[model samples]
Target chain A: MILDLHNHSIKSDDGRARVESYCQWIRKKEIPIDGFVLTEHRQYDDESDYRALEDEFGLRILKGSEVETEYGHVLVFGVNDDLRAAFDFTRIDLPLATVLEESGRCGAQAVPCHPGRPNVGLCAHYETRGVPEGVEIIEVASGGSRAGEDEAAAALAERHDYAGVGGSDAHIVSHIGRCATRFPREIRDEEDLVAALREGGFEAVRWT
Target chain B: MMVEFGDEFEFQPDVSMPTVKSFTTEATRMDFWRFTDHEKARELGGLPGAIVPGIMSQGILAAAIHRFLPGSTIRKIDTIFRAPLLVDSSPTARGVVTHVDEEEGTAEIDLTLVNEAGETPVLGTAVVEVARAE
Candidate 1:
């Protein structure tokens, strides 16, 4: 099965598109992908509703949060209440290291979003000491405005021998499913997605 | 006080950050900004003085914006921290309106986090969506 591992819904403060709108567009376009991970900015309070929508539409859905850290946006998967309680993303003051350490504590997977994008990307690691430990995944390709940065991110992932994933980073319906990760195993739930990502059970793929 | 297009707002408020917990994330602590400031802590990765992480200043800037325009969504913020903000002393954050787009209903606000003696440490530019009075 295919999963658009990164995208946002109206739940994200920056997002104005509805999740159902993306679903309808996916159906009409007959997109090869099966579902997407709705990564709202620093919020994941709509998991159950998305799961219900999944059951109704016969498409799988997962939940994640794109956190604005001191450096850039970090995509966090498998977060729980404890993780949410750890940092305030709106503050934009959440240190990257703090989020990684807390992700470890919450048993969540922490991946840097768009490592090559400027300002809000990992390319500016010179400001800090270096890449922090515990980061295992990087978004090599995104459906956002900075597709050019993908090569650098892919290069970073290859050099570090880490897994590279693709996410649309879509705040709108049109960008949905433009980038995704082809998984070796079917991801029926959030746990499976996290496990597949960590075990290298997927490959990043993008359309154009 | 009706805020005009070029009013500079100054606030010398107490700033508190998320208490740095154990390198271990566990329970027990109500302190604002790291319950424990341990020296030689491995989690800190070794640094001089109990300096606040640069990220917290961004939150302080957000708070400043929120106070000025309640219910306004802070769309994006850009901050550059020139020096380490010491955790023990009081630092002030100031904001000024740089531009106003009446058609788009947005305003560009700039912020500066300063030391007690008045040194600009963190500089920020934020775009806030607001409904300005016509």
Candidate 2:
């Protein structure tokens, strides 16, 4: 199963695409993916109901978040009450360890994304502080990354032997499904997504 | 002309309903219902009236900057729209130069558009290339 693991809708401060627009684009383009994840920046709107759109589009739309940390931005899946109570997602200076370890403890996965970009990516932080302790998954292919950024991120993942995933990191509708992750098994929900990341049966893929 | 740090400027553009509708309509091509139809906007959990599109708010900031720095080129402008600016509201676009690189002939400016209620609906940073000395 293939899924665009990172996306942002109008809820994100910088995101321009609407939720329905993304689905419409994906169907129109006939992108060969089962679904895409809505990884909004800073905060997750758990109250957002996409059931009707999902039914109409025949796509799985899961909710996740892209949050800032001292080590840069991390994509978090399977956010729950415990995770929300522990870390305020709005704080840009979240501790890397807490984000990674606490996410794991709360049955979630926090993967550092765009690891090649300057300030926000993990490559710069790794140069200063090596790899943080619970970082097992790295986003190697990001659609929003500039020319050489994705290559650098892939190299970092290779150096650390971390399982890599791909995401569109799409803030706009036209860019959705540009990159994705291919999982060995189907991901029915956020729980399955977390399990897939931890199980190591997924690989980064780019859509042609 | 060398752009200096802490150089500030302000502009109060026309944020009236017709102006907002014209800008919003032209920008979105009338495809975004929330910006064109008040009833659709309200039904979709948006403002009671059409709101100024965020891109238009950015455009307002860009226009303000152009007025302040006449011959300068805006290399990049990254903005975050914090709140919605209603069509009928009045807003003041203000800019402050935060950094200046003489060798590169560039300056970084922080920009904001504050509504009548003193709430900043649009805030951003812009990198502009100052016109060199003749």
Top candidate, metric DockQ: 2
Query: After superposition, which runs of candidate 1 have C-alpha atoms over 4 Å from their true positions?
Result: A46-48, A145-147, B1-134
Docking level of model 2: incorrect
TM-score winner among the candidates?
A: 2
| A1-208 per-residue lDDT for model 2 (tens digits) | 9999999987988876678868877887689888999999999889899989989999999999999998999999999999998899999999999999899899999999999887899998987887788889989998767557888998988888988999998765656798999999988899989998889978899863
After TM-score superposition, the amount by which residue A162's alpha carbon in candidate 1 deviates from its true location, in angstroms, is 1.8
lDDT of 1 by residue, A175-202 (tens): 5788899988888877777778878968
Candidate 1 lDDT at B26 equals 44
Determine which window of 10 residues in candidate 1 chain B has minimal summed lDDT: B22-31
Best by lDDT: 2
True contacts kept of each: 0.00, 0.05
lDDT of 1 by residue, B1-115 (tens): 1344554676765543333342112433333223235354224635334555555668778889888887677888877665566655688878876556677777667677777
Clashing pairs in model 2, backbone N/Cα/C closer than 3 A: none
User: Where in model 2 is the C-alpha error above 4 Å?
Assistant: B1-134
Residue A154 in model 2: shift from native, Å? 0.9
